[model samples]
Target: MEAAGEPIPLSALQHAVYCLRQAALIHLERLWAENVFTAEGAVLHAVADKGGGRHARGVRRVMSLPLASRRLNLAGVADVVEFPRVGGQETPFPIEYKRGKPKLHRADEVQLCAQGLCLEEMTGAPVPQGALFYAATKRRVVVPFDADLRALTEAAAADLARVLASGETPPPTPLKARCRACSLHDLCRPEAVARPARAWRDRMVAAEVGPR
Candidate 1:
C-alpha cells in the first residue's frame, strides 16, 4: 500500500511489467517520444477523452477519469470506465484503449489491472472484470480480475514505487524484439552498453595473459 500523498501511476506498472528500464526512463527522466504506434494510440485516446459524461443505455461511460489505488500505489487516468446496471445499480467496469492487438505480453494486463485496483479504491466497489479495447482489431477483450492478475498488479505497483523512489534509470535488457519497437531505442543505445561490457571483459582477459 502507498503512503498518504504518494500516488502511483498506472503506466508505471505496465513499464515494470514490460521492462524496468522503460519505466525508469518515462517516470524518472520524464523523457518521452511519440512513435507511429504511440501517435495512433494518442488519437484513439483523444476520441475517448472527448466522449465525456455518462451514457443513457444503462452504461455510464466516463473518459479520462482520474484514479488512484493506495494499496497498489498506482494512479492514472482511465481511458474509459463503463458502469453497467446490475441489480438496479451501476457496477464499475474499467476499459483501457490499446493501439495494437493482443500479444504474448502481460504488460497490457498489468496496466488494466492497475486501473482496476485504482477504481476499486476510488469507488469502494469490487471490480471483478475489465475490458481492453484494441484499435488494430477494433475489438474488446475481456479481462477477469483473478487472483493472479491482482497479485501481479500489486507487485508491479510496489516495484514501480521502489524504482521511482530510487531515482535511478535501470539499464536496458537489449532484446532485439524490444529494440525494434521501443521509442527510446536511439536514446538508450542498448548495443553500446553490451559492447562495452564485452570489451571490458576482453581487456581484462588480455591483461591477465600478457604479463606472463
Candidate 2:
C-alpha cells in the first residue's frame, strides 16, 4: 500500500508518464482490468521473474533484481540486470521486458531509466545505460541515461507523488489510440464522459468571455 507521502512505485512513474488518470486509477483507486495487451505483458514478465542468477559469456546475469532508490523514493524489481566487464570492472546494466514495440510515448524509456536510478543507488556505481527488450519486435533497444531522460524520470516521480497524495481521479480526455489499448477502457468509459466534460469546459469558457 502507498500513501501520499510514501515511497512511490517505479511502475507508477511509467503509468503517470503514459497517463495521469490511469496512474490515479491504479494507485489511488486500486482499480485494474486485464486486457490482451496487459495479459501479454504479464506473461513476458512471468518468464523474467524466475529470480536467479547465472553467468553467460563472462557476464553475470541476475533476474528479478530488487531495486530501491532512497534519493527518489522509488522502488521496483528489475527483470534482468547484467554485470558485464566494462573497462576491466563489472558495471550494472538493466534490461526491461515489454510486450510491444517502441511507441511515440516515452513511458517505457522513463521506466527503464528509473530502474537504472535504483541500481545506481543500491550498487553505488554509475548506471550509464540500459536496454528494453520488446517481445513484439523481438528486438532490444539500448537507452542512454542522459540528462534529458534523468530529468524526465525525476519529474515523473514528482508528478506521481502528487497524484497519489491528492487521491483524486483525473477526468478523462480520451485519445482513441491510447484509450482503446488501455486495460481500464471499459471502466474508464472515456467516450461516455469526455463529451460532457468538454461541453462543460466550453460553457465555462463562454461564461468567462461573456460575448466574444
Candidate 3:
C-alpha cells in the first residue's frame, strides 16, 4: 500500500472518480476486498495482458504498459497501449478494460485520460484519444482527450491529493447504489455511519439523571 501524500496511484484517481470517501478508504486506510464484480474485472484484464506486444495491420499492441506522470504525481499501468501507424507516424492510444458496461460517470474515462497524460509527459507527444473495452458489451468506446476530460482528470488527481493530505476517510456518498456493489461494502459500512446517533452526554443524562 502506498503511504498518504506519496505519489498517488492511478487507481486512486479511479476511486475518486467513483467517490472521494471510497478512494480514501482504499488509499489512505489500505482497505480492500474482492467481490464478483472485481473478480470478473481482473479476468478481463488478464486476457488483455496475454496479448502483449503483437502487430496487427498498422497497429502495435502492448499490454500492461507502465505509466507515470511526475507532473501530476500519479502512477499506474495501462491495460493496453496501441501505437497505430497513421500516415507513417506512430500515435499512442490507450485502451482500458472494464468488467461492466460504460456508466454515466467518468471514472473509467478519467483513468484513460490520465494514462494519456503520462504517455504525453514521457514521449513529448499529445495523446488525443483512447478507448475503453467493456466486458459486458465487449466493445470499444472511443474517448477524446478534449479540454473537459483533461480538466476532469486533473481535478480528480488533485482531489485525491487533498484526501490523502487530510488523512481522514470521507463519509459515504448519499447515493446507496454506489455502495451496494462495492467489494468493500462490509468494511466501509456506509449505512452504519449514515445512521443518526444520540449524543454521549444525552445518553449519560438519561441513564444517571432522569428518564423523562
Q: Candidates' TM-scores?
A: 0.87, 0.94, 0.88
**Tens digits of lDDT, candidate 3, 91-183:** 899999998999888999999999999999988877999999998898999999999999999999998897788787877755677888778
Better by TM-score, candidate 3 or 2: 2
Error of 2 at 172 (Å): 1.7
- What's model 3's TM-score? 0.88
lDDT of 2 by residue, 1-212 (tens): 38645788888888888888899888888889999999999999997889999999989999999999988989889999999988898899999999989989999999999999999889888999999999989999999999999999999998887767776788887888988899998888888888899999999999999997
lDDT of 2 at 19: 87
Models ranked on TM-score: 2, 3, 1
Give the 10-residue window scoring lowest on summed lDDT in candidate 3.
193-202
Give the worst 10-residue stretch by lDDT in candidate 1.
Answer: 1-10
| Better candidate number, 2 or 3, judged by lDDT | 2
Error of 3 at 59 (Å): 1.0
Candidate 1: the clashing residue pairs are 8-75
Off by over 4 Å in 2: none
